[model samples]
Target: MSIWKELYDIFDKERSRWQQSSASKQAIAFELKANLGFLADALSSGLSQSAIASGLECSIFEAKLKEGAALTALNRRKVTLTFIGEFSEFAKYVGKENDALVENAYSKIKSLQKLVAAEPNKSHDLRIKSLFRFLVFLVAHLEEQPLSRTSAKKAEG
Candidate 1:
């Protein structure tokens, strides 16, 4: 089966299990997957109102999932975001929307400018932090569609 198909299967199974479980945690997981799947389908079909609604639902579901995940992940080793580079690539890749990201970057740069003016010595850290924040925003934006298999191969290279 295609990777997307496999993922859909996995998500479907997990959602089913979650829905059946007595645990609120499982219910939350089910909701998260449902929203994610809806978002994926919507984006694939070209960002219709349904897709936007799904994305918004996913955002809400994520809040709950995050709380659960955080409790578990807190005990695990933390992976730094530095390896991923900037979130702009993610924004470009997933949401395929760049205008808002461009505006965000512009705003961030302006804020950094003010900071730099006040304390030139901290510019290095400020730049790094700004880059990290922008990248994270972009990454979250991109989590919607993902890349095509052929494009993924090119990206890996």
Candidate 2:
């Protein structure tokens, strides 16, 4: 199977699992993590294609995909950061009382951004590695949060 197809399947599975489970804050976080994973894979795959095209001296399609992937990655990163910010505000409003968690998430996001900046003209492999690291940190943060009442009910059911 193509890497893109595999990534889509993974994303679908994660989304399905999240929907079947209780839609808790942590569950939402997991969903976001899945999304980030999908984007990372897509971006990496596109970069690989670009590299292949360059090596093979192929047509323009690969270049287009490469450009599109970069734009997609940038947009996704922005959206992810925005979502985290909004989630943090919501946590505060609901009295979830976890400033540290929000701070940690922000820290990871900034770290990922810095990594991208450090290698503006580097290989996509490096970016993919950084993305995986970010995902790991994100998952750890999500795991630390308390499960919602709905999640508990779903688990019991």
Candidate 3:
């Protein structure tokens, strides 16, 4: 079977499982987090720099516009897949640029991936708020700055 088909089948099962019961809801939540963690790793490992940069753009937009309040585990599957589709398509148009911003964004996503595993007792709402703040900074900072990030700057003497 094709990768797309396989991914759809798996997510379909998860979505079906989502509707089954309250207990299953918790399982789906963890699954979404784990998926994001795996996604970060997979995207980091294999994709071209331009593609990853595109993904980062999509990630930042999704996080900021939705304001985290709208992004819950229930909708995470859709969000994740949409990101993959968008970035891959967007990559075909953009050129190699913003390597530093791409790397920085990748690091941030890695950090976000780790947050899910870090605090088991924390409420998802709190985690969402924290992630929202983190993403908000990216949108704010990136917009104000130019994309000429060739290298990380050293402290000025």
Which candidate has the top score in lDDT?
2
Where is model 3 poorest over a 10-residue stretch in terms of lDDT? 147-156
Regarding TM-score, does 1 or 2 come out ahead? 2
> Of the candidates numbered 2 and 3, which has the greater TM-score value?
2
Q: How would the candidate models be sorted by lDDT, starting from the highest?
A: 2, 1, 3
Q: Per-residue alpha-carbon lDDT of model 3 for 1-157, expressed as tens digits?
A: 9999999999999987655433433343343344344445544476443333233223442343244222232222211222223234233313322233333344655554455456544444433333333333233232332212132133112
Model 1: lDDT to the true structure: 0.42
Worst 10 residues of 1 by lDDT: 70-79
State the lDDT of candidate 1 residue by residue for 102-137, as single tens digits.
Answer: 334434544544655565554245353444445434
List the global CA lDDT of all models.
0.42, 0.43, 0.38
Which pairs in model 1 have colliding backbones? 87-135
Q: How many backbone clashes can be found in candidate 1?
A: 1
